[model samples]
Target chain A: AQTVTQSQPEMSVQEAETVTLSCTYDTSENNYYLFWYKQPPSRQMILVIRQEAYKQQNATENRFSVNFQKAAKSFSLKISDSQLGDTAMYFCAFMSGTSYGKLTFGQGTILTVHP
Target chain B: EPEVTQTPSHQVTQMGQEVILRCVPISNHLYFYWYRQILGQKVEFLVSFYNNEISEKSEIFDDQFSVERPDGSNFTLKIRSTKLEDSAMYFCASSADRGRATEAFFGQGTRLTVV
Candidate 1:
């Protein structure tokens, strides 16, 4: 069984500043996928970014980038130039490459971006 | 820019009653899934459906829970007997392929309140 952990329960960042959310997972599978998802008050789950375990290079999507350390079983998200719209609950998820695409998610971290 | 869409943003049902959550996945997607998040808890995988049958399911998906692709475009999760603990946000997701091969798009969740 794979388990994703997000140690930070709550985070705050000033608008235009950068913030990093930490995530770690325990998985025996060598081939897997890691993802970060955002959920606003409307309860919509939006994909932030994803990283393949085999990729040495991190994944970056505009202001959202990931630091994936396969050896350490760590995958963190860095939000650069954070805006008020970035305030949301963030979840870290794990998925085995060979399975039916079921995702194991961590307890979400609620983020607040203030002006 | 295709996305998954779920119906009835909120549902309120009495204990022992039945509730059905519906989703319309992306037209081209081949894999579908259902997940739930209890308030203040991690998101948990419920079931995954492919080729018109359930490909995988978690232990949490007991006999009381069922999934169906009754038509060409609609996927549904049915709870035979709702319990207070069943109150949570249910999410529907879909992808073109497996976890390592593609990204899964999620729909806005349905909040189920069991009374």
Candidate 2:
């Protein structure tokens, strides 16, 4: 069994600032995938960024990047130059390489970007 | 970009009634999945379907729940007898393959309100 944890239940960031959301997971599988998803008020779940466990380098997508420490079982999402549109519920997810499309998600963090 | 489509953005049903959520995955996707998120909770995996059959499911997916790919493009999740606890936002996702690098795209969730 695998579990993803987001310790922060709520977070706030000033507009144009940077914010980091923490995530940790417990998985026995050596090869797996980590993802961050954003759900806005519309309830649309959008993929923010993804990191492969085998890749030592972190994943970056425009303003969204990740700090993945495989040894520590930590994968945190960093949003740079955050904007009001970045306000949403963020979730950390895990999927085993061999588990097909089964994704286990964390409790999610409610992020507010204040102007 | 190709996107997964789900019908009836919101559904309200009485307890003990049957409810069906429908989805149309990406044209090239080979894997389909169903997940649910109770209000203010983590997104939980329900089932994954491949080749018209379920490949994986979670403990939350009990006998009352069933998944089907009745047609070439549509994937469906049915709750035979819904309970109040079953009220949640149901999401449909699809992926091209079962690889560590591939990512799953989620649809705009359908909010199921069981009263």
Candidate 3:
């Protein structure tokens, strides 16, 4: 079974600054996918970024990027030029490469972007 | 962009009552899934459906829970008897394919409250 861990329960970042949320996972499967999801107070879960385990390069989407270290089993999310809209609960997820696309998620970190 | 849509943004039910959460996945998606997140907790996988049958399920999906694709476009998660612990935000998700490279798009989620 795969397990995702987000050590930080709460985080805060000043507006226009950068923030990094840490994530780690334990999975025996060699082929897998890592994802970062954001849930605002509105309760919508949105995909932030995703990284393929086989890819050496990290994934970047707008101001969101991931530092995917396959060897260390670490996938961290970085938000640059953070804005107030970036305040949300962030979750890290793991999925195997098989036919079943079920995701294993971390406890989540509540982020607050202060103005 | 195509996205998944879920009905009954919020549902309140009594204990032992039956409830069904509905979702309309992307038109081209081949894989569908149900996940739940208790307040202030991680998102947990419930079940995954493919080809109108359950392809995978987690321990949390017990006999009380079942999933069905009753029609061409609608996917449903049914809880035979709701419990207080069943109170959570249920999210429906779909992926274009079954590969790890493909990302799953999630719905806004339906908040279920069992009283």
Candidate 4:
């Protein structure tokens, strides 16, 4: 079994500033994928960024990036130049090698961007 | 960009009643999935459908729950007997391929309220 943990339940960031959401996972599988998803007020879950366990380099998508430390079993999401639209509930997810799109998600962190 | 669409943004049902949630996946997608998030809880995977059959499902997807791809574009989740615990936001997702090979596009969730 795999488990993802988001220690922060709530986070706030000033507009144009940067914010980092922490995530950790316990998985015995060596080959896996990590993902960050955002759920806005509309209740739509959107993919923010993704990182492969084999890739030592972190994944970056525009303002969203991840600090993936495979050895530490940590994959944190960093949002730069945060905007009001970034306010959402963020989830950290894990996909084991054997499963087809079976994602294990964390408790999620509610992020608020203040102007 | 192509997107996954779900029907009936909200659904209200009585206990022991049967309810079906609908979704229309992207035209080119090869995989479809159903997930649910209880208010303030982590998102949980329910089932994955591919090639007109279920490829994978979580333990939460018990015999009481069923999934179907009735048409070329429609995927549905049926609950034989709805319970108060079944009340949550159900999301439909589709991906171009299986496993971690591709990212998934999620539809706006359907809020199920069981009373």
Best by TM-score: 4
Model 4 residue runs over 4 Å out of place are none
TM-score of every candidate relative to the true structure: 0.96, 0.96, 0.95, 0.97
Instruction: Output the worst ten-in-a-row residue range by lDDT, candidate 3 chain B.
Output: B96-105
Error (Å) of candidate 1 at residue B85 is 1.3
Candidate 1 structure quality by residue, lDDT tens digits, A18-96: 9999999999999999999998978578889999888899999999999998989999999999999999999999989
Collision count for each candidate, in order: 0, 0, 0, 0
* Model 1 regions lying over 4 Å from their true place: none
Docking class of 2: medium
Interface RMSD of each: 1.4, 1.3, 1.5, 1.3
The best-first sequence of candidates by TM-score reads: 4, 1, 2, 3
Candidate 2 local Cα displacement, residue B107, angstroms: 1.2
Look at candidate 1 and give me any clashing residue pairs. none
Deviation in Å, model 1, residue A100 alpha carbon: 0.9
| DockQ for the candidates, in order | 0.75, 0.76, 0.71, 0.76
Native-to-model Cα distance after best TM-score fit, residue B73 in candidate 4, in Å: 0.9
- Tens digits of per-residue lDDT, candidate 4, A4-24, equal 999999999999999999999
Show pairs that collide, candidate 2.
none
* lDDT of each residue in B15-98, candidate 2, tens digit only: 999999999999999999999989888899999999988899899999999999888899999999999999999999999997
Question: What would the per-residue lDDT of candidate 3 be over residues A1-115, giving only the tens digit for each residue?
Answer: 8899999999999999999999999999998999898989875678888888888999999999989888899999999999999999999989898748888999999999999
Q: Per-residue alpha-carbon lDDT of model 1 for B79-105, expressed as tens digits?
A: 999999999999999999976637788
